[model samples]
Target chain A: MAIHPLRFFDVNCGIGPYYNPPPGHDPSVSALLRGMDELGIAESAVYHFQAQQYDYRVGNETLLRETAEHDRLHPALMVGPGHTGEAHSPDEVAALMRSGGARILKMFFGVQPFVPGPDPFLMAPLLDRVAERRPLLILDHADIHGVRFDWIVDILEGWPGVKVILVLPKLEYHERYFYALWERFDGFFLELAGDQTMGTLEAIVARFGPERVVYGSRYPYFTPLQTMLQVIYSEIDDEAKRKIAGGNVRSLMEDVIL
Target chain B: MNTDSGILRSALAGEPLDDVLVIDVHVHWGRWLTMNLPAAEDGIVRKMRRAGVSKACVNGILNPDVAEGNDQVASAAKRYPDEIIGFAALNPYQPRPMIDELRRCVEELGMRGLKVHQMVSAPAYSPFPIDPLDAAWTQVWEYLDARNMPVLWHGVVEEAVIARFSGIPFVMAHGLSSPATFRALARYPNFHIETASTQNTRWYMAEAVDVLGVDRVLWGTDAPLDDFAHRWGVILDSDLSEDEQRMALGGNAARLLAL
Candidate 1:
C-alpha cells in the first residue's frame, strides 16, 4: 500500500493539435505537462502530431520551437525512409535531428506510404545511416501498418547498431516474434504502450531483464496512467520496476551518440 | 473530484482500494485458440488478488466445446466460490437445444449468467457467421428473459433485439466505441456497458458517462486477456466523481448480479 518510489521518463508521447482529436482531449504541450505531473511522469520524449499528419520537416521544426522552453520535454523528430525526397537524405535528417538537440527518431513505417517495406536494398541506406548515428529509433507498429515479424527481423539484422524501441505493437498474439527478436538483437527495446496482456511484462523482464523494457504512454491519444500502473503493480522487484519506469529510457537517451 | 482525490492518490501509489468494492465482470479461464495466455485458474486468481479484485465473473475460452467449457467455469467457481462467479457459454450453432444447456448450466452448474460470442469463427463451433438475432437463439433469450437473468455479450447485438428482450440485463462486454450506438441505446434501461477494452482512449470513460450516465457503466478488466491494473488505473484516473467511480466499479455490477 506504500507509494512507489519509481520515477517515469516516457519514451513515446505526442504533442500539438490533432487533425480530429478526441472529445475533451487537449493535445497542447501545457496539457501534456499537466497530465505528466498528475501521473507522476518526471520527463517525456515527444513528437509533433504535425510530423505525423503533415510534413515531417515542418512538424519537426514546430516540435523544437514549441518544446524549446520545457527542458523536461525532449524532442523526438519524425523521419521517413527518404524515398520521396520529402525527408531529403537520411544523413540530412539525422543531422537536423542532432542539431535540434533531439536524440530520438520516430518512424511511422506502418502508416506512412513513402516509407517502403523492410527490403534490404530499399532500406539499407537509411538503416546504415541510422546505425551510424545511433539515435534511439521508435517504430510505431499497428495492424493497419501490415508490418510482419519477418520484416522487422530483416530491418534489425540490417541495422544492428540502431537502438529500436517498438511502440504500440500487438503483443497478445505476436509475443513469440518479440521474444525471438529480443533473443537475437541486443539493441532491441520495447516501449510499454500497447502491452495490456497479463504476465507478458513480467515474462519479458524475467527473460531479458528489465534494462530492455522502457515505460511509455502514448499521450494525447491514450492515457499514461494505464502503462504506469502496469509497471508499478508488476510482480517484478522494485529495482527492476525502477529501471523500467525511468532508468532504462534515461540511460538510452544518454547513450545516444548524436 | 480533482487529480488529488483519495482514489487517484491510492492508485498512483500502486495500492489497490480497500475501502471500495472492486469486481471485474469480464474474465475467462482455459487456453485461447490463437495465442498463449495466463488463462489458468491459479494465475488468474493470483492476478485478481494482486489487483485487489474481490470477485470476477468468469467464463470459459473453449467456445467449441460448450459443455466442457461450462464445466470449467463451474469447477473454477466451485473451487473459489467467494472469488469466482460462473457465466455459462452456449454455442447456439450446436445441435443440442441451447435452452437445455442454459438450464443445465444454471440449475446444475449454478451459473448466474450466460456468455455468448457471435463474432468468433471457429471451425468446430461456429463455422459461418450466424445472426445472433436468428431463431436459434430465441429459446435461450426467452429462458433468460423469463428468469430475469443477466447476459454478458461479446459481439454486437442490435438495439431492436435488445429492446425485445427488455427483461434480460445485457452487459456489453467491451463497451461501444461509437457514440451513435451509445445514443441509440441510452433509452434502454437493460443495456449497460463495461470499461474493458484494448483500443480505448483516455476520454472513453468520461464520454461514456456523458452519454449513458455513470449508473449504466460497469468496470471490467477482460483479465488474462488484458491486464487488470491497466484498466483499473484508467478508471481511477478518470474525471468521474468518487460516487460515480464506485458505481462504475462495483455498484452497478453488484446490483445487476444481485451480489
Candidate 2:
C-alpha cells in the first residue's frame, strides 16, 4: 500500500454466511475489518447476509452484535415492505432504527422476497417513516433486467426527504438508467462498485462531480480492491478522487441527524 | 489534478508482475452493434493499454456475413499478435458453415478459442432459437473438444452438452451463469469461468476461487462493451492471496492458451 490521496468509505457491504451454498464469501467481523484495514477502507455501511437470505430480525441482531465494537462498521439493516411480519409497522421500523443505531436501510427487491412498486399499502408508509429520520436508503440493483428505474423515480419523487443510494447498478443499465437518475434526482447517489467498464468512473466524476459517486464495495460478496483501484488509478484529478473515495460518504454521514 | 502522464500506470508498473500475465478473456470487436458505441479495434487496444491488459480474447461479431466475422478477428489477431488473442464468433443459426470457419480460424489464422453470443443470438432471432445441444452442433463441439480449445460463451448452455464436450474447456463467461450452472458444470474438469461482468468484487472472485479453485477463474473485460479498468479492477482489488490473484489475472488464461 503506497500512501494514496484517498480513504475509502464503502457504502454497501455484508457480514455473516450467505444462505446460498458454495457461491459467496462468509466474512466474519474480524475478516471484514481485516480486509478494510488492508484496503484502507475507513468506514463501511454493512448488513448481515442473513438479513437478506433468512429472517431480517436475525440478520439485524447479528449485524448489531458483530459490528457493535467497531466504530467504523455502521449497520445498514436489511428492510422490506411489511408483508409477512418480516418487517412489521412504520413505528416498529423506527424503533429498530433507533435501538440498533442504524443510520442506513438496505432493500433487496430482486433477490429477497419483496415487491416495491406503485402500491402504497405494501411499502409507501414505511418509506415515509424512513424519510423523517433522514437515513440513507440503499437499494440493491443486483439484476439490471429486473430492476425498474421508473420505480426508483417514483421513490425519489414521492419520498423527497429520504436520501437514496442505488447499489451495484450493472453496466447494462448504467448509461441508460444510472445516468438518468444521476442527472434527474438530487436525492440519489450511485454506489461505484458496479461500473467496472473502462472510463465510466472517470467520466461520471467529470460530468456529475465526485459528490454524486460514492465508493461502494458490495463487500463480502465483492472485495474493496477493484472499485478502490478504479478510484485511486482513475484519470480524474486527486481532489475528485479524494471526494469519491471517502469525503463524500463522510459528508453524507455528517448530514444525517441521527 | 496531477497530470503526470501515466502516473497510475507507472504506479501499477512498480507492483510486481514477476510471474503474472493479465490476459482479459472476453472482448467484442468491430462496429457490429446497431445502437452505435465506439466498437473499433484501435479504441479497444488503447483501452487495453490504459488498463495494463497484456492480452485480450476478442470475438468478432459480423452481421449477414458471419464467415467474414471470423476473418476480421483473425486479421486483428495478426495485426496485434501479442495484445489480441482472437476467438471466432459462431452463429448457431448458421450451423453448417460454422464448423468449417472454426477450423480455418483456429488451424490457419491462429485463433486460440471460439466465442458464442448465445444470449445475444437467442433474443436477436427469437422466432427460432438456436439450441447449443442440437445434434447438428455436435461436429463443431467435437472439433473444439478434439483440439482442446476453449469456448467463451455468454449465458448458460445445457450441462449435458457441456458434459458431452467436457474435453473442451468451456469458460462460462458470466461466472458459470450463476451457482446452479457452476453446480452443473462442476463435474467437468475442463470447465472454467471468466470473471467479467459478474459484479466487481473480491469476494465474488474469492467465491469463484473457492468453488472452482484459482486455476479455473480467468479475468476478462467484455471490453469496448465494458470498462477495461473496471473489469480488471475486479481481479486487482480482490482479497485473494497474491498467487490466486496472479492465476485469475493471467496464469489461468496463459494455461488455457498454452502461452
Candidate 3:
C-alpha cells in the first residue's frame, strides 16, 4: 500500500446466479463478500442478476432479503420503465427505494427485454422520479448494450440531477466516446473495471480530477485485483487514488436523498 | 482469509516486485491508428519500471507498411537493449518475400522472435479473414521451423499447422478464449499460450495452467493496448503457486527466447 491503505468500495457488482457464469465462479452473496475481502474492498453496491435476467420485483426482493443481514453489501435495486407493468409506477419505485434503503438504481437496457431503448417516452417517468431522489444510477455502457450513444446523452440531458456511472466499456478505443461525455457532463463518472486502456486512469485523473472516477471489480466475470492494481500503481497522487478507490463512491452515496 | 502468495502481497501493498523477474511478452511500439499511446519508448520504460517488468518482448503496432513498423521495433530495442527485446513484425500479403525481411530483422536488426498480427495482412483492419492454413503462409512456417525461432501470433492458426511447425515455439497471443484449442495443442511440446486478451475470466489463466502446464503458460500484458499492472495483477492473484507464478511471469519466456 501507500502511506495509507486506501479503503475500496465497489460500485459495479452483480450478485446471485448468472446464466453460464465462468467455470469456478460463485455468484452468491457470500462469494462477493469473500472476493471483496480477498482484494481488501470494504463495501460494495450490489445488484441481483435475477433483476436483469428475470423479474425485477422478485430480484429486488431477493436482493433485499439476502443482503439485509450484511451491512457492507448495499442493495442496488434494478428498475425499468413500467412499460409491461412488471415494474411498478414511478411513485411506487421511489417509495420502494426509500423503504428498501436502496440509494442506487441499476438499469440494464441491453440485457433486459422490457426496456429496449433509453428513449425519453420509455424512461422519463422512472428517471424523472429517481431524478428527484438523485440516487446513483449505474448503467452498462451504451456500446455494450447496443443502445445508441445519443440515447445516453438524452438521459444525461433530461435527468441532470441523477449521477450516472457508466461501467464496462471495451478496454481499447473508447476515448472518443467517453472523453467527449466527460468533457460535457460533470454528473457522469466512470467505473474503471472495463476501461483499462494504457494511461487512461492517469490521463482521466489529470484532466477530470479523481472525483469523476470510481472503483469497480465486475467480479465473477473478472478479478478485482485487475482494476485495484490499475488504481494503486497509477501515476496519480495518493489522495486521488484514495478517492477513486472509495471516497468518490462514499461521497456519491452520502449525497443520496434517501 | 490469509494467503501465502508473496506476489499477491506485494501487489496488494502497492509495491513493485523488485525481487521477481517479471517479463511481459505482449507489448507494442509505435503509434496505433485507433488509440492514443504513450509518446515513445521512454513511456513504455516508465510503465515497466512501475510494474517491475524486467523485460518486455515488444513489436510495432500493426500497419500495412511492415518494414517501417519493424524498423521502429528495431530502433527501440537498440535504444534499450537491456529492457526491450524486439520481435519483428511481418505482413504476409506484402509483395516482397517475407523470408527476406525476417532474415533482415533477425540477422541484421537483432530481433529475437517473430510477431504476426493477421489484421495488418488485410488492406484495412479487417483481420486476416482468409484461412491461416492457406498455402501462402507455408514458406513463413518453414523458415521459422528451420531456424527454431519463436512466433507470437495474434490470430487463429489451426492446431494441425502448429504441429507441422513443431520446431518453432508457437505462442498464441490472446489464446485463452478457447479451451478446446488448449486441449488440442497440449500434445504438441512446442505449443505455448500467452494471456493478454480482454475476454479472459479469472479462472482462464488457471485453466490454461491445468491444460498446458505452468511452463507452457506465459504472462503477457498486451501493454499500451491494455494496462501493465492490470495484467500483472491477474497472474499475481491467480490460483497458482509461487513456482508456477515464477514460470508464467518470466521463466518460461526466458527459456523460449534463450534470454
Candidate 4:
C-alpha cells in the first residue's frame, strides 16, 4: 500500500504536565512529535496543560521553548483575564504573542478558576486588545452540560474581531448553540476533537462548509490517529476533505496578525 | 501491519474484517439520554457489524423496570448466542429479588456477568447518598462473590469494598472518570478496568494497560450511548503492541466471560 503525503493541521493540542493524563502517558514534545509523525499530522497548534491547570507563565514559556525546536509545532499561548493576575490583560497577552510568535490563544475559563466573563463590562479592556490582534482563541468546553457558552457567546457578541474556536463540543449542544453560532459568525470555528457523533463530520461539512471545521487531535489526551483517519476516510469529497484536514487551520494561522 | 490503513478502511466500511478479533465488553440496549430506539437489539447488532465487533456484552438499562430490561438482554443473548453476551443489570434496591433473578439469569437465561450503574440506578431505587456499602446490597454481593462472577461497575465504590469482595472480578467501566478505580486496581488483584465512553481516551487506555497490564484492561464501547468506531479506534490505534491490542480488544473479556 502506497501511503499518501502529509497535509494536516491540528488546531487543538496540549503539552507540559497535564493534571490528569492516562497512566504512563508521556506529555513531552518529543513524544507528541513522534505520535504526530506516525499519524502524519504536518503541523499542530498546541497549549500547555500546566497553563490550564496551574500557572500560565510556566506552561506558556514551556510551550514556546519546547515547540520552538520543531517547525511543525506552533505554540498556542494559554491566557485568561488578569482578574487575580494568573493571566494578563489583552495588551499584555498581545505582547506575549508578539514576543513568543504564538499564533493561537487557548483558554480554559470553564475548567480553570478564571472568570471568562459574565460581566463583559469588566473584561472589556482585555477583550478589546484581543479583538484587535485577532488571534484564534480556543476555549475548552469542559463538559456536555452547564458550560458557560452563553457567557462566551456574550463575549463574542461584544468583540466580533476575536476569532473563537471551541474544543470538546458535545453532539446535543452542537445543534443547540454551536451550529447557529458558527452559521451566524464567520469568526467562529470548531475543532474536531470532540465531534464524536457518527455522521456528524459529513453533516457539519454539508451544512456549514468544510472551512468552518479544523483538524484537532487533542493529543496526549486523545488518539491523533482516530480523527486523522476520520477526516481521511470520510464520505465527503477530496476538496472538502483537504479544507478540513489542513486548509482551514492553515488559513486560521495565516490570518493571525500580531 | 503494512496493510493497517487498508484494514481500517475495510473495518469502517462494514466489510469482512481481518484476523483481529474485536470484542466490545460494554454495550447497552433500550433507550438512553433523550432518545428512544424502536428495536435496541437490532440497532446494537448493526452498530457492532459496522464497527467490526465480533462480539459484545450488553446491559439493558431499563431502570425502574429492571426486570423487563434484564429479560430483553437475556433473550437477545439467546437469540444471537454467538454474537451477543448478556450481563444481568442488577438493581440494588431489589436485592433479594435480584439475587434469585441473577441466579436465573446466569443458570437459565445465559447471563455471564453483572452490570450495575450506581449513579443511574441507585437514586431512583433508593434515597439520598445511596451507599454501595449499604447492608441492602450484602446478600447480592455475597451471592456474586460465591459465584465468582465479574461485574461491570459504573460508580465510585470504595477500594475497601472491592478489596472485601476479592472473589468477584470488578471491572471499572469508565477508566478516566474514576480515580478511585485506578486506586482499586493498584490495591486489589481482582479489580480490573474497562475502556469505554468518551472518558476512555487513548491516553487513558494506554494508562490502564500500563497500570493493570493488557490482560486486565478490557475494550468496551458503552455503545448506542457512544459510537463503536470512535471508542474502539482508540484501542486499535493506540501505541499498544499487537498482542496487547488483541488482549484488550477481546482476549481479556473472552477469559473473564468464558466466551
In terms of DockQ, the best-performing candidate is: 1
Clash pairs, candidate 3, are A1-B13
The pairs that clash in candidate 2 are A196-B230, A197-B227, A198-B227, A198-B228, A222-B201, A222-B202, A223-B201, A223-B202, A225-B237, A226-B237
Candidate 4, chain A: TM-score? 0.91
Candidate 3 docking classification: medium
Real A-B contacts recovered, model 1: 0.64
- Per-candidate DockQ vs. reference: 0.57, 0.22, 0.54, 0.18
* Clashing pairs in model 4, backbone N/Cα/C closer than 3 A: none
Model 4 per-residue lDDT at B100: 78
TM-score of 3: 0.94
Which lDDT tens digits does candidate 4 get at residues A1-258? 233343888887888786676667787888888767655678888888888787878778777888887889889988766767767666778888988888788767655334453346666767777677777888775654656667668878888877878777665445547676875688877777753654566667778888887888777666766676656555578888889889987887787787
> TM-score for all predictions?
0.94, 0.78, 0.94, 0.78
For residue B192, give model 2's deviation from the true position in Å.
Answer: 4.3
Residue-level lDDT of model 1, residues B71-185, one tens digit each, is 9889989999998999988876677777888899999999988877753444444568656677767878888888888898876356776999999999887774555666778
Chain A TM-score, each candidate? 0.92, 0.91, 0.92, 0.91
Question: Which 10 consecutive residues of model 1 chain A have the lowest summed lDDT?
Answer: A110-119
Which candidate should be chosen as best, given lDDT against the real structure? 3
DockQ for candidate 3, C-alpha atoms: 0.54
Q: Considering lDDT, where higher is better, how would the candidates rank from best to worst? A: 3, 1, 2, 4
How many angstroms is residue B233 displaced in model 3 relative to the true structure, after the best TM-score fit? 2.9
Question: Which digits, one per residue and each the tens of the lDDT, describe model 2 over residues B124-154?
Answer: 6555766677665787898988888898877
What is the lDDT, from 0 to 100, of the residue A187 in candidate 3?
A: 82
